[model samples]
Target: MKNPNGFGSVYKLSGNRKKKWVARKTISWENGKQNRKIVGYFETKNEALKALANFEYIENSKITFKQVYDLWSKKHFENIGHNRATNIKSRYKVHLSVIDNVSICDLKIKDLQKLYDNLNLSSGTANQIKSILKMIFDFAIRNEYIDKNPIDYLEVKKHKSVLERKIFTSEEIAFLWNNINLKLVDTVLIMIYTGLRIEEFLNLKIENINLEERYCIAGSKTEAGINRLVPFNHKIIPLITKRFKEKNTYFITCNNRKISYSTYRRAFIKLMEDLNLKHTIHDCRHTFATLMSNAEANPASIAKIIGHKDYKITEKIYTHKDKNELIKAVDMIN
Candidate 1:
């Protein structure tokens, strides 16, 4: 009986040899020549044929990330409550979706690390996502889709306390300015100059920026913060202009896509570690507040600029005066 095309072959070699039956597969072709690999040399044709069959079966059975996740969740979901299962599914969609079509064998630690580092998740949420990945890799290993789990090598560091208002010193600010070309340092500089919350800066859209006027409208997380006008610090005008010209929808981005908060947080942490600076993302806001206060900038303007609705007088009364005050306050940061 003839074998199917590309199924590989088992045949006896002409040379005198201890094991004459050879099983080989054509892996590639170059210069009109077949580049093949011998699976094995066997004592009998049947043995060689069996080896080829096993090789083909293994090659054909390689599973993808999505496939293994589906298989794993079937039994996993059955054992857990519907709500818990749904929550796992949600995390998988948000965090693991990037590698869905990737084969389990091809998935690498760096691939996982890139995704993990880019997210701005809390420690609990980060651990939850990591758990889901660990389960999928374990499933793959048990099923023989892959031998080693890449997740075993990954290290997820604990998040620092963001509540600590440890502001950057003038010396550290000078150091950052000198090293502005470093990755994400510009982001930190922007945060310091503009006094934006991490999320607010990340969500700043192109439409909200006025490059000519040197101001942007952005805010969130509070009634006072919503759509407030923020004047740009003179030092960061070039930085903002550079980002604006990228034509991205958001002012801050990674690979032309909206960078998630958790990813940025992780990268920010790494940056701090590299620079040997002890601070949090929220610290940039604190630095701004401190800079403004130290400069003796107007309290009304400071309150408005930082999006605090704490002024005794109604913000409606100072709206016109505050715009000029906000610009003046930003300039005073020097």
Candidate 2:
């Protein structure tokens, strides 16, 4: 069988005869410039030769950005964390997967910008997509697939508007306590006083409670959150004593059954609706922080108590001034 010396050769191995065609072309130029390399195998001899021809043709015509990016992503994200890799792949599936067939040369800055802007995702998510796109384009440039990265000029817009969270006032809190089932009131009050996230509160086990030390160790969302010792408020003690007698395995439960997220969510929603309040169960945490701030509690201490990674988050977002506190402060103007 005769094959061109410069072009790739297609051959079947002796032991694996009738196997699919295997083709290999050297990574060298036509003008006597050579490099040591073996390229690939294909389903047929024509397919192998066609790949070689395209390899030569690609010098003049560009490959798709998708083709370049897919290769790039494999190497780029190989060393990243599993959770992070999953997140990046999820974004690619939703946003970048469609444009995989578009040529790199045809992709302009505006084309990418339009794709990003159309998503209308959260600030954090939008920024993640922008960062990933730039990396993909940078990969294309480094691989000689494109001259410059169009993603360099792209800007991800921030959603400037912040959502207003509803927190309960002292009066509203008392009204809620007075209205709900006496048994459920303990769980609600624990969340309000302890500043524990609803899920964290639900996951508390019998061993996690330390009555001798007066601080129950719980919370597992972040490094700061894990095993945080939240001191029990005096009011929730009676409820604890009652539960201790019942000998339930978990801290929060219904008839010895674990209080699932859905069950708690439904109960919270029902309570809010009954009270005609516009607040989620998480607002109990906000209320605790607000009350602490009003009592002149240290911001750093508040952050630590609530399992915040940084105290600045507590100062900036959690420690808000109530209307009564604002009025009292203004009255002190002499």
Candidate 3:
């Protein structure tokens, strides 16, 4: 069978064998040298046609990868949650320059693999790049700009290093609470008491805290976007209530203006240095989960409080349940 464009050919291989399809595009260089390139070879005509159609579509759109990516980024900025949109824009600015000029359909998995290999980037960073590219491709496809995502076939290498899940001991927590200034102390305290992410902590509003109900309704950054109501015991209620008079906006920020992640991270690092603590801000969240598990809180309940989808996520990430509580779990095993 001949291609619709009369630029390629397809043939049946043999009995009990599939058909072979090939696509070729020829062009003359600036120096008048002719070049013929094989765009793709597929086992099925349908697959070949799909690829050809994608190529044709891209060529016809007359849109550069940069143009499409910019459009995607703008739409993404408008659609995604604020924190997520910020992260996507930051990542794209850092790693997407190389492929910005190429057409979307012409971006091969091999090209992406090579770009990833040369970047000297961490697996997590590479994965983020892949994710951003996938998002852009999804946008393109949804808008009928392309037929398939070439990025789907690319794989990111996994880093074997396990993340540190440090949980502050009760004594350490008391030491931190006593030493730090009142302004920043409650931020850490809230994270330890509620297992909320630092981002979530900064985003919390006065309305989320219901003194009458004794629970704080907060949104998590997980895929499901779970909004959990964490019960505030007598201890945490007074701490949050005291701050109610300061501002009606976020609990952590001073001016109600959104603080960047780097700003908070730097502040936490300075705080840690002053205290001579070896733990990260995330450890406060871990400490909350550990303390809860030690208090014999149910795994499912802990997961719910932390906005995790299920107990498995809580267990997988916070592997170090308090030893005494672990013993109780162990006792049940036998």
Candidate 4:
């Protein structure tokens, strides 16, 4: 007897097979051809019939991986911090391209494992990808799109990192100091002397600087760093005063307006090109830390001034120290 239309079919295959009964369904059609998909196999006709009846097809609603990710990230990105959301989006855009268009319901552990194994990234980055996949799968499951997450079984391989943070050498520092009158060179000196992260420096407001006290209350990225008092080195005091007198809302400005990192980055690239220096903006912070350590600044003072929450400093020294001690530490750099 013929089965009802669109109900799929169960039939027995030719003799040598152990699971002779096959369950098949018409998943799609193209150019007058029915694209039959194999649902599963069974040892008996009744078993195949039961399996076919129980099998779920994505005929009505097809949810692709990208679709789920879009839905998940739409609400998810709003609640998380900007940096974290940017990192997640970057990983998704760069690394998860393979499964982007594939239907979420069709994904399996082998596919996920293959995707993970093919990536050659740092352990932290690779693990982040795994975590992103897991969250997407969990979203699908929550929405009744899939019964289980394939990422649960997928394993990521870790690779050793060779990347190192390079700092400005003493000679390079001298070159910068001598050329400080050049365009945007003073900003580099400010970053180096104060140990401000690139973001913190870009976001520094004029109101935060106390010219007489010679310190700026500014920070970001970590609890220890936020709204902290960072004393200015005497060498950059002239530079700071000049910038402060500009009367712009932010101390760091270009053409009488607040400057952005991208704009500053382009200018920095040109400056580096001219000076023959190979360094990133963050390296200024590294140079500051190195200089302070060489001057034998207290470890706790270093951590406190830099917004790092070192265990030893946090437990023993950072709590007891005050702004005066930090000022003493800052003065040790030069």
Candidate 5:
């Protein structure tokens, strides 16, 4: 009755001290003085003890967003390569990293939604951020930091005018072909016909291509972007043959290692300036799908060639407006 532990003392202080149990724990010493905190009040001793145990565990083991993210970043990006890890970290530093000190249990959907709203990222990037956030929260939940993930039911949505994948019109494709010089013409044609993303095309090593098979393995990022086979057009054959003649590590070699995306991007910018054309390199892939669809290529074949897991996507997002066909249909409607 004289000596007591800070966990809580339930002694008769008044007419046989009421059976009031106060759950308490010492977080730390402040200014060389032991500082105590009251966790909660319970009706029974066992309840108070149980509460104290939970409070101790949570207080001692609470994971911050930084810790969870660090753990997740290592596992998710494991063996993914340095470039990808750097890219992932860049994205994280902008949003997720800001809340590094915030406990995962304290992470709210609204907190995340605010970050998303302010990011001004494209639909794809915003979705990616959301995915990573949800994943981190899921990890937190598994570790018992929180019972449920706040992001699991979060209602964050992409803006209506979010930047979408830019597709090149048929005429634009024709113009690019006409103006593409010999230096990078093969690069352009390979991209246009194979539906390879710029990164995929630029990063292509000899192992990723098969001259005899007339197909190139290209992809990155998603499931559709890994080890996907892109069949060549009749036109890309000659170009591939020529490139094969030159011994190089990457398909897009600039005298040595595969030309960096930045260096080549600047060159592409200069070419676009000279041609007075405005389009991202990704437009080439979109142009490929559009051209394939216009040529009445089977949807399944197009999806496979483009490495799309969902074939319907080719019909939905890849198809572009045909004014002539629209006019014909409208005339029938009238």
Candidate 6:
């Protein structure tokens, strides 16, 4: 029968499992063409009535995608992280004009997939878009804006892994230590010695350093960003001392501001070219792990130093045993 609101009709279907309720709405275009659509199925008759009410409201109000996204953003800003929210808002702006006039309920998976695939974005980036859509739909479903998640079955194509752990040779490490510009020499040395992520290094403060203890406190990027004390060797001590003499600030910087990752990466690329080495800034951390493993540093000790949440993750990524050492251990059993 016709809904009192005049937006749609509701019907019940018999099934072995349970009774299913369905709502249908019709839309007329400027060309005098009409299209009928089934909004959703509900498990309970009461839920179906609620769905019919919502459908009537949506159809009557002619709500837009932008309007719903804005409403969703307001309700769930805290659910998203700071870094992620920034990117999501930026991407939404780019796609807003094309989809803004479209109804929220009419947002099909194909439309989203087409938008996702047409962009010349990395797989990681595509996944982020997918995640934002998922969050939006999840909020809608939770609030009963929609009965089911339309984009739930959308598959994000996986990109081939390009990042490999490159173990820097001793010569390459020595070359980098000796050849990088003197301005960033101390900062690079600190990374080599401490294996701190770029963000952690940039955020380092003078108060975190304990000169007497020959260590510094820093946080990691991962959820394991708990404060950890990293010990410094003799080589790093001189570098830190020299920096302490030159700058009042805790970190090495150009023009009194913290160095950006892009700046460091460009400089590192030049350094790599000069040394004829092919390695990423990440190689410094891998080199640290390699050297530590070669020195027979205990996995537990290394994990604690690296602020890894568990030794198993450390073992999975960083524990590469030497062939000769393995042979020696095997011989001992014989």
Q: TM-score per candidate, in order?
A: 0.53, 0.49, 0.53, 0.64, 0.50, 0.53
Tell me how many clashing residue pairs each candidate has.
Answer: 7, 0, 0, 0, 4, 0
Q: Comparing 1 and 3 by lDDT, which wins?
A: 1
lDDT of 1 by residue, 126-157 (tens): 88888889998887777567888888888888
> Model 1 residue 48 lDDT?
94
Q: Between 1 and 6, whose lDDT is larger?
A: 1
Candidate 6 lDDT tens digits, 56-129: 33552366767678767975777877656666777777654478888777888888777766756667766777
lDDT by candidate, in order shown: 0.84, 0.70, 0.67, 0.84, 0.68, 0.66
lDDT of 3 by residue, 173-202 (tens): 888668655456766776787777877787
For all predictions, the C-alpha RMSD in Å is: 15.1, 11.5, 12.1, 11.9, 12.9, 11.6
Query: Alpha carbon lDDT of residue 285, candidate 4?
Result: 93
Error of 1 at 234 (Å): 0.6
lDDT of 2 at 91: 86
Q: How accurate is candidate 1 locally (lDDT)?
A: 0.84
- What RMSD value applies to candidate 2? 11.5
> How well is each residue in 1-334 modelled by candidate 4, as lDDT tens digits?
8888988998888989999999998877899999887877889998888877876565424778988898779868989987688779878998996778898888878878887887777778888888998998898777567898888787656766645679898889999999989998999998999999988998898888898988999878898888988988888999988878536888887677877666787799899999999988888999999999999998888887788888354546685778788888889976
Worst 10 residues of 1 by lDDT: 54-63
Clashing pairs in 2: none
Model number with the top TM-score: 4
Candidate 5 segments whose C-alpha is farther than 4 A from its true place: 1-81, 85-116, 127-158, 182-185, 219-226, 313-334
Of candidates 6 and 1, the better by TM-score: 1
Candidate 2 lDDT over residue span 71-140, tens digit each: 7777777889765776787788888888877888888888888898787677777788888888888876
